[model samples]
Target: MKRPSLRTGVRWKISIAIAAVGALVAVALSLVVHNSARVSMLDNSREVQLERLLFAQRMYDSTKEPKLGTKLNDPALPHDLHVKMKQGRRATYVQETASGVPDVWAAVPLSNGTVLSLHSKFADSTTIMKDLDRSLIIGSVSVVFGGCALGVLIGGQLSRRLRKAAAAAGRVAQGNTEVRVGDAVGGVVRDETDELARAVDALTDALNERIEAERRVTADIAHELRTPVTGLLTAAELLPPGRPTELVRDRAQAMRTLVEDVLEVARLDSASERAELQEIALGEFVERRVGVLNPAIKIKVVHESWVNTDPRRLERILGNLLANAAKHGGTPVEVTVEGRVVRVRDHGPGFPEALLREGPSRFRTGATDRAGHGHGLGLTIAAGQARVLGARLTFRNATPEGIEGRDGSGGAIAVLWLPEHAPTTTGSFPILKLPG
Candidate 1:
């Protein structure tokens, strides 16, 4: 399974969403608290300064003196306050800085040609507000980080379960019918994910049952028809040599071939066929098969590698490929052996678009010169036999280079990849190339 990108995966999306929401809420709360606290603190400071100003006024009235407090004689007092006092204002207050500290000042003009002023420092309140701001900021950061951590932990678990289910489905698609997502670790929880896993398992089970039933029915029909087909062929052979006899013999032979092919297909579906692996020189094996089929076919040897595989299945695959090329393609068929691979090329009109796209279907022949020669089981059987031998068989239209037909058209090429080691008992065919 491929890992998803961090920027695009569900885990990151979830984490980011949670963190954003948490940060927004945290900031809003901090602003509300800070603004309210600042207003209340400033009001209290103003009231304290007012009480001090009234006290100074009372002392000046009783003693007939204007110098009532140390603040009235302080040099830091703004000149504007004294000017406002001299203009005979009842009371005056203003915010100013004294000795580099924030302070509120209030003044009352006395009849003795003097101003009584009161001052209060706000340094303690300001320090407290700063500390609160710092604490709120730290708390907001902690909340955002905690939300992200929680989101990641939950998202990781959810993604893991989904990935397991997807991987199981992939295995089923690749022909492993026994795979089931419901058999995952951490047990099954009664949730939507569990339901999905169960549904997939049920579907796989149903498909396996239906395929098995079809295989059984096919195998039975083929087995039953074999006896009658053999009898017909025997009786036709006993007939006197003539055109009629030849016709009967040919029809019977065709019937027998069809039945045999059907039976082989049934075996392949049920995996009843097994490979008998043996060590053989790859070059010699391919050459022998080609020699038996056609003497004039060209052979190219790039490497004399050896392999362990089923000789019978290998021959069957090669023979079918060669027959298919000769029937549908042009002349000068070429077989090349390099390492553990064998490629068969024919110079003729290339494979039809339908065949190349949909692959070979049983009894469905390609639209070509040899369209009515035989049933389309040659390539199908070749593919099945290659699978049984733990090899990969693929077909494609040959490239148009030095190999072109008389009509200036490309041909078809079939490639078979054989592993160096024998196929495992479990039928898993992993490609393993041996050092030359």
Candidate 2:
């Protein structure tokens, strides 16, 4: 199941990183500005307090009274500053108040063991700094919000481009070599995403070239061998009838079959290949086909199903699968049918890791030394036919690791699931008698 949103995780991760960086920078800048302003305000308050203390001393010397902000041994003065004054050292102290304001206290030792102290509150500076701090906070928030918005735009663009590239790669993987990441490779070599798009496009081109070359070679070889193989078959028939003649005829027939398979593969590689649909009693048809192919293969119809498919192509696929199993797998191969699905399993060394990982490749058989191997075109041809039929084909080891081909444990299993072409016969098809 897919999520509701088309947005990828990379987008959100990028946006989050941008938002976090913005928030961190804003907080740091706000703190630095706030602290600097408070320190400057305190310094100014201290200077004002000290000047007032000097005036108060002069005022007392002349009129024996203190100024409005100045006092004689003021108890309101900071205790620390008062102690300093009593020790005969002029001092000023800054004190913070709960009302978001601060007071500066200054004192001097007077003659005859008296003290003159002055203190002033930073009332105006407090209100001004409060407004400044509020402005900083709002600006910081705006910065963070703006950064987030920018990040969203950038992230969305990047995600969309990367997805486009990925989609192109997916099409290429599905054998659509014509797909290209043309416009998806946006910008002038700016980022890794753009580079990735270019790389995928290049890979598609290379794959297209390689497939074209392979198709040509396959077609040429198959056509070239067809005449000679057919001639050989004719020659074998003309020879005197004996065991040697039968062996020659069999070899020539195998050569002919190989040539035909190569031609089929080449045709399937082309885009013009198509399926010929026909309705059939799928289980009955499969049972008959299984019997004619090999009498030893055990086949069962679990639930009968009627489907529309190309019977000739289906037979080809089944024939190839059975032949592959009998040649490279252990004895007692089994075939099961349920609905529109058919599974072929054999007891053998199982599929190798390379075969499981990379599906079937031409001329690459995953068989042990005992069972022998073929040209490796069997599974590959079946896979191609499945594609034409719009079916899903899968290969896997039916048994657990290290237990394959041992004590009846299953080895490789190939499943062919055909899409129901909306068969007119909606009900289940009757089960057919299968061969022993």
Candidate 2, 92-197: lDDT as tens digits? 8978888867777888898878888877777888788879989998999998889888889889888888878887776667666666775655665478886777
Choose the strongest candidate by lDDT: 2
| Model 2 TM-score relative to the real fold | 0.80
Quantify how close model 2 is to the true structure by its C-alpha RMSD in Å.
6.7
Residue-level lDDT of model 1, residues 1-436, one tens digit each, is: 9987645766777898999999999999999999998778777777777777787677667865544453444465567777777798744454645554566777666666666677667787778888999999999999999999988987777778888888888777656677788886234455677889989999999999999998899889999999999999999989999999999999999899999998988887786678988889999988988898898999998998889888988998889899888888888799999999999988887666566666677788877565888788888888777767878776777554335455634678888998666766423542222211
Model 1, position 131: C-alpha lDDT score: 94
Q: Considering only N, C-alpha and C atoms within 3 Å, which residue pairs clash in candidate 1? A: 330-348
TM-score of each: 0.75, 0.80
Candidate 1 error regions (>4 Å): 1-7, 43-130, 185-191, 238-244, 352-359, 365-374, 400-409, 430-436
Q: How many clashes show up per model?
A: 1, 0
